[model samples]
Target: MADALLEFRGVNTYYGDLHVLKNVDYSIGRGEIVCLLGGNASGKSTTMKTIMGVVRPQSGQVLYDGQEIADLATSERVKRGIAPVLEARRLFPRMTVYENLEIGAYTRKKGPEFDQDLERVYQLFPRVKERRTQISGTLSGGEQQMVAIGRALMSRPKLICMDEPSMGLSPLFVEQVFDIIQEINKQGVTIFMVEQNASMALSIAHRAYVLQTGVVVLSGPAAEMKENEMIKQAYLGEMQVEAA
Candidate 1:
């Protein structure tokens, strides 16, 4: 049966009394690729952190699979099928690529299933197979990003939230990153990402939300949002073409 896989209702958050996210209400349907769009400090990252339980919301409800999960711990949230790829590319610098991914699945039920998880991660990043023993710190920026993403997928979560996955990459690599996001979504992994690459986000996302200083100023189908006047004026720098 269809259901709202994740929901944030009237959520409010504060960083030491400085309000960050204000009454944010959003939801992601099962298997949907939704992009959260905003400039820096627009509460995009805060939203992801709040959902992942890294930052507790000062108010409002966070629901996952119809259960209120606002009170859960970070590890508990991961066990409940919510995994996040942070913008910081937080991989263990001294660890081998395989070791890093293995760590991501540390909370899983003990069994042969853990090995199976490694196989799944290798499938997504075949280069990971070639560099399984290499230290993540020595890898290039793009490779580090891959490790971060691969690690998140190691949990085999139903939803993956990536914060600015394309930041700090060469122009050539940016296209490759977007393709990877698309490929993952095609494999039926729901994605909720915060991306500053406006054009790429709108083109790839199935739907998107535009946040302005902790408020959702625009949201709709990806195609429609791509053409939105505010989005074009601010991000695209051109009006969207009408259907001919």
Candidate 2:
């Protein structure tokens, strides 16, 4: 963890009288794919929000590149090389695909670098390029997901925090999206994802943490977690039942 890109040290977060995150500690090393796994009502989404500065921790530290960012604004966090692919693919419904992508770079000035980044996004999602002029709301679910990811990449992030990348999509699209996530990670951007699709997330993640209520119950290498009996019963087995 010497080269940790993001770290949470004994972090605790609350919403009014309710405690959402309880002394959580997480360290995401540079160039790694880390996933957070949990069921409904767990603190999974809260963790992502805490990192993005959407929610402030009541105590403990949130550090990025060794700098404290708990008090930073969301825009400042994005400016510091952290971008989020928020839950549910929140795209501007009235805007064209290209315009939605343009919004992603709001923190950066439009320049030659922006153009190059746009081309990179296009290369990653050719379908997005084809639909650049089309309204984002009109695109299919799979295509929308692609554009959501493309928009995140347009920020040129060092760490991409994704909340449920496989939330709603056909099986084919889910597979494609996960494949694209791996491809992006291979290009050296660290990924911290919160996913309900346990099997798919674990398959691609280097490490994973399991949250229950407001506490981390289990965490370790993804391979070992996949083989864990508790994990199988709690997550993978449930997935199989749904598939059945």
Error of 1 at 86 (Å): 0.4
- Could you tally the backbone clashes for each prediction? 0, 0
Residue runs of model 2 more than 4 Å from their true location after superposition: none
Q: Write the per-residue lDDT of candidate 1 for residues 1-244, one digit (tens) a residue.
A: 1368999999999999789999999989888889998877999999999989999998999999999998899999998788888977889999999899888887786468877777876776777778999999999888888888888878878899999998888767778778888888888888999987788888898888889999988888999987678888776663133111
Structural RMSD, model 2: 1.0
1-244: candidate 2 lDDT, tens digit per residue: 4389999999999999999899999999999999999889888889999999999999999999999998899999999899999888899999999999999898899999999989988988888999999999999988999999998888889999999988888899899899999999999899999988899999999999999998988999999999999999999999989878
Count residue pairs with overlapping backbones in model 2: 0
Ten-residue stretch with the least lDDT total in model 2: 1-10
Q: What's the alpha carbon RMSD for model 1?
A: 3.6
